[model samples]
Target chain A: MNDQTLFSIFFSAMVVNNFTLALFLGLCPFMGVSARVETALRMGLANIFVLTLTSLAAWFLNTYVLENAPYLRIISFIIVVASLVQIVEMVVKKIAPVLFRQLGIFLPLMTTNCAIFGLAIFQTNRGYDFMQGIVFAIGAGLGLTLALVLMASIRETSELSDIPAIAKGTGLTLIIAGSLSLAFMGFAGLL
Target chain B: MRTTTPAEDFVRGIWKENPVLIQMLGLCPALAVTNTLKNALAMSAATFFVLTCSSVLISSVKSLIPKEVRISSYILVIATFVTLADMLLQAYAPVQHKELGAFIALIVVNCMILGRQEAFSSRNTVYRSLLDAIGVGIGFTIALVMMGGFREILGIGTLFDIPLFGPNFEPWVVMVLPAGGFLMLGFIILGLGVFEQRKKSREAAAA
Candidate 1:
């Protein structure tokens, strides 16, 4: 397989094919945790951390463990992701309680974020080697962070504006996300 | 938990507690695969199979799973069914399977399945869990089909690939794209909100 340059992979994942805006991988938290810019940034950092770890774990599993037993990919990936998040949560709680408090339930909830699983699966399917997979995860995590920060900042301002009764809450957030997705589509030519 | 009738358990998930429209659970597949009616139907069918089977299995085996590891156990059960569904689709409907891609496997992480297990099946009777799963599954299918129908008709001027408009009909290309999925669901949720408000006001006026 011809490997894509790390820069291209990073740039593509960050903007051209952003995980949240383009791929629809992690909309739950993209919507749920994006209400405030500060929280969103913290969540993004957590995502980046877990995603990088996931890349390492998934690569190890794919190259070493799952080569012969491909059917076990889904199950093993889920277990690995869940436990990894748990370990991260515990570590964060131990080392940085302030950040842990800010992350709160969202940290643990990352287990089902789908973006993590999507990243692992995509890396495997694309046959990304160790370095490529790690770069891709970092790029995706940054992409997600960018989307979250943008949405959260806009939402912070929108709170003062008069949204229609019908378009408040989730409806408004989703419409905004749709617009963001449209804007991101402009970057499709970058690759 | 308050006691409820079987009918209530089944009906609530369809409307009052709709996993997609009301609760906003499991949105990735709802938005990702609804670009076409066929893909949406296949995804929903696969979800229904996995959800129903896992809910039944989990409820039946709830006691054996210790509280500390119940979440893991539930995931294991759900992942098993998802794998089965994935393989079944691969063997039988390879085309649809390819269209669905990793989404079929991603079903293992779908919050709806895990939520139902933790919230309902783990506590409720097997019969009630079955009803709840069926109701939620049907609700999800309804939502996906509605979205798929809307997107397919506008994006491609067809429903299930049957041309609805004349050959001259122009398609709104965005309706089939990722942006369109978000916009469509946003509008749908908005419409539902308006409907709910009117119903509430009407009831207040009557009272």
Candidate 2:
């Protein structure tokens, strides 16, 4: 792929084809941690960190491991990612309690987020090099953050709206998400 | 023991604490695979097999598992069954194997299976855990199938690849897309809310 095309891949992945909104990756955290705006933002940042680091590590591992040892790639990749999440959790808890508290349990939730794993697999599938993989992860993580923050903002305002009793809480949220997804469809060809 | 039965354990999973509709766990699979009845049924069966096997194995050795490493143990156990399900699907139903992709691999992290182990199985007897597994598995399947049926009928004017609507009828393509899954879930949750409220009021009047 041309170097210029790499930048476009990164751009489209982040804004035009957001992982959470456009591709529906990482719906769990998008829905779960979005109950509060502050938590959403913190989770978004934490996700950026973990996702970028893991994508870089995963890219390097993919190149060396899969090229030479295809059989053990999946299992080894998962173990590496899991351990990396654990290490980040410990580091954040010790170094930044404020950030940790805001993220709370969600820090660990990153291990099973699926978006991270999917990113790794997607990068492998697309055959991105190390630099391209990092850019893609940054874009995807930003996309996830954007979706979470927007959903939280909407939910925050929705708390006071005159929602029918039967459609309060999750029902309403899902509807809003559906509409937002519809809106995001407008960006399908921005690339 | 005052009649603590395994049947009761199993039955509770079907209704009382369903991993999907009630507990609201495993929403990814619930939303992702419920586009068609066939996919839903396949997903449900795969989940049931994995859940049952994981429960049996986890419960049998719950006491033996040290508290510090329980999560890792559960992951290993769940991963084993996920591998089995993945291989079976690949060998027998290659089409579905392609359709499901990484989501099948994602069964290792669905949370429902692990949540059940952490909540009920770890402390219960193997027979009781088996029953609970079946109940929850069936309950999860019901939700997926219902969602899938609605989407297939409305979104594609078909059910399990059979055309139900006349040729003149135009399908709402949105219903077949990912957005459709969210919309269907929203309406289903709303309907359930209305049903629950009505039931509560009726019970109150009777009382």
Candidate 3:
């Protein structure tokens, strides 16, 4: 259990192996929701909540239920994620309609966000205990939020600049993302 | 509603409406597993199989699925085929399977597969859906190959491990790294945009 301390795991997942900039997980939303900082923050925060919850659920599910049937991993993980998002959406709508209105569309989409799915598969692969898995999830979430907010701010600023026609929409975004990723690579030896 | 010809529907995904480069459907594999030509081809083959088969299956049974549970059912269908593809790869091409790892399973979450199911497969006939999937799948494969080609040639100084640039070439290590994927894809998209614009302007000038 003490093979890797909690702080190192957190730092590695959050900074060293960032879900978006480094691993390229959840890139669809990273590129899509990042156009506006407000929506990006909302989406990032929502993902943190969803990813943390899913990680916990997935840890238990893998430990107890799906350990025996390795083949069902894909279907089970996706179904669990989908159902969890649905549950979270309903609960949010009933309890906090404001949050739901802000987050409703992104919730269902999280079902397909590779980060959540990747988080599930990754934790199991790493064989992290419950506590470690939670830390990792939180770290990944924070990393995702960090990447999204940064990209959103940059895109917001880029809108004011005169960009060439060839690299306008997606092209410009990719180049910026690539540059951001390269910058984040500086955290390689932090841990 | 305007109906496009079947040939156009099939050809569009190859270039005009490429799922990877144009519509940007599934960018994960476009960046993740495309470091090598072999892995890229395997990934494309897996996606092609899953997309085409799932589209046919979903379209054939679209009427039976209630609207309320369509997404869940579509996911279920996609996951099953992804697993089948995963197993087939593991059995036959173990090296690629190991290399691909979570990505093969990640295919279930590929927006392209699910997008086709939700947008085209569920609405169109089975034949049309199959053709559309094949088109998009080919486009995805081609784009991935191009990305892989550039990465392998520059990043590793080889294409599919064939000595392309010879012994004197110094491979650009960044090209195979994650950052390189983004940079290469960005430039490719830009190049495609430039090509399209020039073609359109040339046509207008001739006219």
Candidate 4:
């Protein structure tokens, strides 16, 4: 396990193994919430914060508490992520109202984002230690952020293109995403 | 809000409120599992089983659960059923299970299942919830099979491993890949949109 270098994991997770484009982790928000660039950026940041905490807590529990009963991993990990998101939501609301209004509205939905859940599940399956798990989470979060921001930028411009009437909303976004997914495939050789 | 008929609840999920094509929920498995017909069918069956079983179970127990912990309870129920389905597939059909890999467990995070439990099962009667679950399950399965058929036919010139096209036909490799999944889904949405609009305009002109 240690043979795989940290830089490789970070780079692969961030680009070659993106959660949305490459792995199809969080397509709902990748499509639904990516209407504007600012909102997408906020959602990405919020996901990074929550995902880091989730990876930390999930790794701790998996290593120490639920070491024997691997079957209970999913139920326990979900509770951990959900509760963490709730805490982050409230804390963000009280400490920074402006930030809250910008990103807080998207926190609750992040619970079911699948990318966060996928992060914990992947790190667990990969058997990453503490420091390694955090690094992987950061990479995954940044990967998600990059995908979201890029999709938002394209969709924002999509409005200007003289798109066919039938392919106005999601149809057009998906076609563009397909192209992006193809482009991301070029990073496959980097590893 | 207008009260819906029991039959309406059962029927709407297939198309009008279809989870994948219309609402855009559960896109992960839709794209990942549709490369081949068998995997698509297996994934769809597992999802349908979990969604329908959990919907009924959650609905029946909805009253006993407190509001504060309802969401957690829902997760527990959904995860338990997903595990059961995963185990069943692994034991009986190891090949499909291997093909599905982590996506089976990832079903726990699918917004459609959780969304249905929160939006429908948590409030409705068990029978009604069951109807809604079956409807959505069938709808999701139909979408999977549709996309899988499209990809399989184009990618390999075969459906369900049976040769449909002769040696002259050259398969488009991209259709079997992840990129093709997105493009196929996009074109389907576009076709549906165009069909719906044309029908609307025709009716308007006649009226």
Candidate 5:
């Protein structure tokens, strides 16, 4: 287990096995919110924050609480994530009103992002120690951010080009994502 | 607030309001496990089970759930059914279960199921909610199968593991990769768009 260094885990999650492009974890926001670079960056930041929190909660639960009752993992994770998002929403609203306004619906929607939940489950399954899990979460979050920003920037430019009617909207975005995924596949050689 | 008949509710989701294609509610599993037809079918079946069960349960108990905590309650109910689906798949089809992995658990967060509860089930009668859930479930299944069929046939020159192409056929290995899922769905949606556009123009010409 310790044979795998933290940097490798981080690198693998960020590029080699990106949560969005490769694993298909958080495609919702990847498609939905990638229309604007600014929104995508903010969404990515919120995701990283939430994902890190979820990793901590999941590690604590797996190590101490869920040792015997493995079946409760799914139910418990969902509840924890949902409440965590709620708390995050409240805290953000209280501390940074401007950022809260910008994040708006996406923050609440983060609870259902699947990427966060996927991270928690993946971390537990990998049996990473606390530090490793944190690094993994940050790496996955950055990967998602990278994919989102790249897609958003591309979409921003594509908005200017005259595209065929049939291939507009989601159809076009998905094809772009495919090409991006193919490009990211090149990163697999890094390891 | 026009009323929709039971038949309309049932038929609507299959095409017009398709949870996957039209509304784009559940794309995670649609893209993740669709590398093979078997995984697609299994994943769709699990989603269908959870969707229908949770819709029925939520609609029946709608009045009992307070508005303040309804979302949480709905999620809890959905999670329970998802848990059951996860265990059943693990026991009956361990191989596919292993292939699908975190996705089955992730189904609990599938916006499609929870979306149905919040949008339709919480207000509609139990019978209508049942119809809606089944319709949406079938719609979701159709999209996944379309994706699965396309990928499996092209990626491996087979359908359901049965060879369709001669040995000489060169498979487009990319079709089975993660990229293929996105490309196939993109093309599928584009095809639908063209079909819709042609239909509208023809209808205008006839008129």
Candidate 6:
């Protein structure tokens, strides 16, 4: 049982290797869903909820089931995460309909979003215990949210500018993201 | 039911409305894994297997999927095939398996596969869906191979590790890096735009 170190984990999640800008784990939503700032925030928050819970769930399952039954871990984890996504979608719809509407298709899409699953596998890779996994999830979720919100705001502004027709939507977005990735590389050796 | 001929179904994936370059689906794996000809071929084959199987299964079971819970159903179907691919890669091709790593499992979430199953397969017949999958799969493979060829030759000065360049050649290290992936994709998109423009002019002249 490795004792959780808060500083290192936070650093690792935030700077040492950011999920979106650095690792490129979840670029689909970063590009597809970032058309509006409001939608981006909602997606970011949804990610936070799912990422946090997935981490806790994955950690518990890994400790109890996967450690003993290594063969079953991958299948079991997906099953658990899949059902949990359904439940979360339901709970959000019932309790927070407005936010749910804001999230729309992205809510269920989170179930398969590589970032959440990546978090699960990464936590396992880093050998974080339950508590550490939760913290890592929260940090990673916040980082994802931050990047999403920032990109959305910038993109909103970018759309208003007179840009070339071909490089308007995805083309410019990819270039901007590439530059953002280069910027994120600055933090590589910090950890 | 208007039966879509099998030949048309298969041909669509080859050019008309190709998934990777034209539709711009599944760029993550297309760019990330295509560093060498061997890797691109391996990734393409794996994708083809998973795609063909999922299309067949999803189309066959499309009617059973409830409208309200269709996405979940689609994901489950996709995930099962992704697992099968993951295990196959692990068992048969350990090196490719290690290189593809999380990306293989991430295939379950690949918008291309899921997008097709939801968009094309769910509504279409089995034969048409099979064609759509194959078309998209081929399109994806072609894009990967092209990107892999450029990156391999320029980045390492070698095509499939055969050392195409002489000793004096200095490989552009960036071509193999993540930045290079984006750069190559950017130029590819630009080239397509140019081709589209030329084709439009030629059509105008014909008219």
Model 5: how far is B30 from its true place, Å?
Answer: 0.3
Docking level for model 4: medium
The deviation in Å at residue B176 for candidate 1 is 0.5
Tens digits of per-residue lDDT for model 3, B21-131: 889989988899888888899999999999999999999999999999999999999999999999999999999999998889889889989998998988888888888
Which residue pairs show backbone clashes in model 3? none
Docking class of 5: high
Winner on lDDT between 4 and 5 is 5
Provide interface RMSD per model, one decimal. 0.7, 1.9, 0.8, 1.0, 0.7, 2.1
lDDT of 4 by residue, B107-134 (tens): 9988899999999999899999999999
> Model 5 compared with the native: what TM-score?
0.98
Between candidates 1 and 3, which one is better according to DockQ? 1
Q: Which stretches of candidate 6 lie over 4 Å from their true place?
A: A1-5, B1-4, B61-70, B123-125
lDDT of 6 by residue, A102-137 (tens): 777778777667788778877876688877888899
Error of 4 at B201 (Å): 1.0
Candidate 6: deviation at residue A72, Å? 3.3
> By TM-score, highest first, what's the ranking?
1, 5, 4, 3, 2, 6
Candidate of highest DockQ:
5
Give lDDT tens digits, candidate 1, residues B24-97: 99999999999999999999999999999999999999989999999999999998999999999999999999
Residue A101, model 6: lDDT of: 83
What value does the lDDT take at residue A51 in candidate 6? Answer: 89
When 1 and 6 are scored with TM-score, the better candidate is 1
In model 5 chain B, the worst 10-residue window by lDDT is B1-10
Q: After superposition, how far is residue A106 of candidate 5 from its true place, in Å?
A: 1.8
lDDT of 4 at B192: 91
